[model samples]
Target: MSLLASEDLAEGTHNVKQGLPDLLRNTHDVTSQWMEENTTKEETELNDWANLPHVVLENVFEQLNEVSLLRAQFVCKRWYDVIRHSASLWRDKSFRFSGRDPRDLTHGPYKYASSFTRTFGRYLERVEFKLFSPVTSSVCKKFQKCVKICLNSLIKTKAHLKDFSMPALQLDRSQWMLYREDMCSALARFFCKSQHTFERVDFPGTRANFDDGYKILYALGYNTGRTVTHLDITDMMISRRPMFDIPQFVECFKHFRCLQELELNYSYISEDLLEVLAANLQENSLQVLSTSVTQHDPHNQVIWGHSWAALANRCRDLKVEFYFQRVMTYEQHFRILLPQIPLSEASFDGCYFADRDWQIRPTIASILPRFQSTLERLIIELPDTREVFETELLSLLSLCPHLWYFKMSAYTSTRFLDKLLEAVSEKRCNLSVIKVRIYVRDYDTDHEEIDLERIYTKYRDLITNDLIDYYATCCVSM
Candidate 1:
């Protein structure tokens, strides 16, 4: 009995040892299978990324505008590195925002974008913000705070912006109860911000105080280490006395050492004021200057030979547009206007030379030769009432060689068209564009007209065949 029991124990031990090996092998197989599944998923994802086209990947990130591009620096390490180093990418994008209340907070589509902008502000190159009505003192303060937040957000990003634009804060006539002082204070703070990040500034029509405008100018001058290349000041409401009396316009401009173009158009500019302005430009880098004549200012009368000659000498290119108070005879007009036409480069707009007393043709013939060589563009606004000037007009065209653009809106008989064809043929005039609007209101209906198409065919070989770029017409019937 003892021998049989020992044999049974040995058999049981052998069975247990075999079972342990099987158990260990099964556990190892399950672990290995799980690891294989996980590794396969990782490899599949990597392969998908590798298969993506290069252009697709680049376009996905590079298609954003300037402001959104600036604000997107914080998206990830890859995006941050891309925008922080690329300046040329942001050159063509415009960045503008409004300064009004936010009435809604729905996270519809741009939740991710809005968050990005808040993260990195003012890396944007340009911004335009709108201001709504009911512009009260409290609303202005709130708007000021919003601007401060945006500015502070921008300052934190360490982005170097090159251009910025904003609208003037409009005043509500109904809300006279609003504090003017508060609004002025808000603007003062706003201008302080504007004095930075701009190389060229234009304010077309701002209903602000003259002092306020000058203050903004002062801030711009004080802040910028060097003056901008171009400055435009226009549409300010200045009376005859106060316009000439102010010295800030001339003095403030002297600060810009590199100013090249200055346009003082549609403003109440005086001859004495212009003289002061010209004196500042005497030896500076000023190249192109434009201004209009207003008859209200007695100081703006034609000291043409002196004032215009001085400016023509100072500027390499000049353009002057004068609105007429009364029509003058061609002889009288030429006396004042001809001397101002620069021999190098010049342009004239919105002037009339009408003479009822004597013949106007000879004076026009004499005056047209000055534009023969150097004039690039001529825009003449003709008198509404018409008189015969066909011979004079043909003579003028005969003198102009290498004329690029010619626009005429006046009365010209069909006889003048024949002369024009002859001049084009004889001179082989290399005209790029010709815009003619013949007033055909008072023509006789019974007469047979000259065929323009026939003339075109006669000189078809001689006519310059540069393909017409644009065409639109309003046909007139007699």
Candidate 2:
């Protein structure tokens, strides 16, 4: 028996039993008989309200949605006491708007709850923001208002905005009067309102003209301290104005000494701009840097010339990435800086085709042999061509013994794939993931889609059963 139960039996037997005399017993009996008749009113009034399963009720309340949960809180003081003490019940309810709805009542109501629930919700350790925008101006106004309200609510609650994506967007100047200014204002308001709470910021669009839009970000990054971790700003058309203001922008990053991963999208960066940005980030000791740019043509006068070569040499310790149309020229540039720093991963999307006006495919394959030993992941996004996956492409890949991941897309023939796989049979490194975007018929309308199934089946066996025990391989056709 438990200690309390055993102790209770011992106390009752020793104190109430074997101690009374015969006369005392008879007197006590007479007194008890009299008392039983009149003392019924004085018997301990048993309060059975506390007998209900309170722990079960607490669990059910936790499973309920926001609206149901609020109803439960009003059920009784017992419930209020239980839930008020439970902090984790509020952490999982934070959600972002669909971006399409203007007055979305359901978007972020957790952020707008009473101060008690709000305080509890601030303990959230993970958050994901899925960004979408309205198609028309009327809807846009409503959507913008919704976002503003949500932001206000979040700020009031002091919600921990962990991961957020603005989903980089491109706006046309003709769409509205002072469009850029309005966007900049919105961005500035967003940053200013939730500067401390917002941690990860993703610019979803590949290209954007830098203006006041960038300044708001600069200000936020400058003051937010080390909370920011991953920053993706790839494929952006950064205007020259933003380019000129880069020194100030970079200085802002110096304040965010905790930045780890940085991405630069489609930026035609000059040598000086690159040098400044790299120096600032390196001072902060960033681990990953991804960059994309249109490759310079010898015939075109837009080349960065020797300036880019210099920046590449300087940022040797950084994990550098470059995406371009002509992989050959980019590889050539990379080769010059390869000696200075060990660039481990490189992606070549949209290879040059001689017949399709991208006339540098021949030169690109020649440079692949140079990156064989050091390159970790080599992604080749092929263009639609009759003889795109030629013998020369397979031969170039055979040189990379250290290559862990290899992928090709856009209508590569089955026979060519077999040959390529056969060639890499022995030299295959520690490949873990491969994604292939399949070819589909072009559509004039917006409803067109790619055949993901066929692409997966084509390379299914090759990627499914990976060689490594802990490594997993996956392929996406679209």
Candidate 3:
């Protein structure tokens, strides 16, 4: 009886132990499956585009164009909310009104001018006026009226007009003669009125008489002095009136306390004006200055080297560009000016360096040393006949430890490319980009058969294996 009872109890205990393992295994499997499903659901919710943060949606909307944004506003309620709340999307609004039709000027049933201003004008930070076919008197009158209406709308809307650009008034000789003064006065009034908030004013292809130019300058100096940071008066036709002297004209620059970039293409820059600029330029704010110099008689002209040197010294971050229309001996001028400025960027375009006395290497050498610590960008375009020395080029590059962007059009051999790579390695130069258009002599067979692909492969190897990152583009010319 005892043995039978003991055997039955042992069999019962073994059955319980075996069944417990299966029960625990089944419980673990169900728990794991539930956890995986919950995790997947959470991840899907997190990655859903509709659940993106408001700031992210705003940023996405900022990249959309006006037409795309207008269409996007109707996509859904959430998108509409994002577009409406995103201030960045409406920060720098611009309004354009083309004066191709006389009816555009009138406040007819369409209310073309006022409707645009009333709806979107409050957000405008820029205004552009494009008047076409201003040849006939009627068209000219309409254009002028449209401009007035636009200006009045801007004033009424109280939009912060930071950038203002106007195309040149196209008119026939008779039309120009009839309306030049009135147009000048109207433009002057607009500038004067909007000067307080204007940060950039571009009046390309505008022809102005001496009086008009003076008025523009006066408006800039007195009204917009503290706010205007960028000014482009490219292709402005100044009357050859003897009454408007350079000294009086340059007096306006003295008031430019906030001017960071000034471009005066095809404008007269006399020695007296340079002197005035040297004395009065906003050193802390003036970062870019570009002008064209046309000195037909280099001998009789007053030397501007000292003034330029002074300017360069005072404005350490200045990127001075001089576009010479006439080929003259500018070596002396550059020699004096380059050593004083810590040029962060320099561009010389259409400059003739084939002059007998133009010692390119020495002039560049003198300039490169001072620019070594700060120079980041350089662009030089020279005559194809001008020779470029490898040693001088290497020396110049070695000095620029922080040169990230380089562009040059010159006569250089293939050895220069090798030397450039070696220099970058030796100097530990952080060169992110290099673009060279080398005019190699046909007889110089050393680089005539150069495999650019092989060079690029080498560059890629350096990037991948050595962790040196840079992009280089080399083109050969004969």
Candidate 4:
């Protein structure tokens, strides 16, 4: 009886609801009708985008590149507010200026890169200006003008930058010398301004001098000495000339206590200089010290065994990598390479010097064993003047367990490959890639010298394989 009474009550409520026409309309339908009646055209057309939170707008703005961001800000007042105030989107990006850029070229070094700094200089953190290349003497003056404009704009809108990469201009020899001083003066002032926050400074191949009591470098070292971590001022002017002073440089080096990676000229590294560096570098931070070798560095016959050993002792992880600008004479090679210095990655562009009088074959293998525990990569570019026996090279490979990549521009043979594969399999060597540019002789031609000359031509040399270098492909594939 109670169940039947409950069913009757439900039926009564359903009938009541249906009886009232106003109640028949759902709450959603009624609300829609009310909104249609009361809302104005302006209120209805309101964009839902304006309701987005500040965090969401900043995130969306951050996705855009500099130019795109600049454009997006003009979309509305809300977007402009977000982009104008946000700091993360502006700092730590690379801006390149080139002749190809569409900016008004007649104005200065480059408006494309400088324009960004000029607009948002207050939010600046990392600024890198990479100039357009293939410059001639006529365009250098314009280049100088552009640099000055860019520098002036950057200085005016001064803010501390973490990374600064001033272009190492590749102008004609006379042209570079003519404008180098003006560039350096501007750079010194820039460096002074950047001293408080300059963490990593790279002015490679600029040959920036330290005359006038080393003012440019002094500002960098003395101001941010303990803070600067990665300094790569390679090819700096530090000679026995009237303006250059080695002792002052040593003092400057003393200030680099926090340096982790350094690349300077091999000529400047004397006993006293390296000693100061070894003493100053923080523990384990100084992993790799790279230097560029010029032909003249061999004359400075300072025994680096003790000083390098001291550095190695302090930072057991230190590895010294040197780049040879020219074919190294055998005596010069021996003089510079010290056993104490840990060499992890080596690039020997040419092993033969002066009519094959100095070849790396016999001596290189003997020297390889010393760096067996450390060496991981080796690149050897040999002139095809003489055919080298693979015995020494294979022996070196066997000793070096860590070697991952090996590239040789040479005459490789079947016997060498067979031995190399056998060695790789036997030792389970860590060697990952083996690239060899195999030189082929034209047997069809009767003139042997002519054939050899044609074979040795820079880019036309066909490999033993029809495709890529068989030596590299075979080793990698296997």
Q: For each candidate, give its TM-score against the true structure.
A: 0.64, 0.63, 0.65, 0.76
Off by over 4 Å in 2: 1-121, 124-131, 169-183, 189-198, 206-209, 235-251, 282-284, 294-317, 325-342, 350-355, 427-478
RMSD of each: 7.2, 12.4, 14.1, 11.2
Return the lDDT, model 4, position 186. Answer: 69
lDDT scores in order:
0.51, 0.52, 0.63, 0.66
- Against the true structure, candidate 2 reaches a TM-score of 0.63
Backbone clash count, each prediction separately: 5, 14, 0, 4
Q: Write the per-residue lDDT of candidate 4 for residues 426-447, one digit (tens) a residue.
A: 5545565666654444433234
Residue pairs clashing, model 1: 95-126, 95-127, 96-127, 96-128, 97-129
Stretch of 10 with least lDDT, candidate 1:
467-476
Model 1 agreement with the true structure over 48-153: per-residue lDDT tens digits: 6444454553465478764676577665555666566554454432222232434412222123334444544434565443344534455554444454554445
Off by over 4 Å in 3: 1-64, 68-90, 93-115, 129-145, 167-181, 204-207, 241-245, 265-283, 292-338, 351-362, 365-375, 383-388, 400-403, 428-430, 439-450, 461-478
- Tens-place lDDT per residue, model 2, 75-110, is 667777766666566655434444446544343432
By descending TM-score, how would the candidates be arranged? 4, 3, 1, 2
What is the Cα-based lDDT of residue 451 in candidate 1?
48
Q: Report the Cα lDDT for candidate 3.
A: 0.63
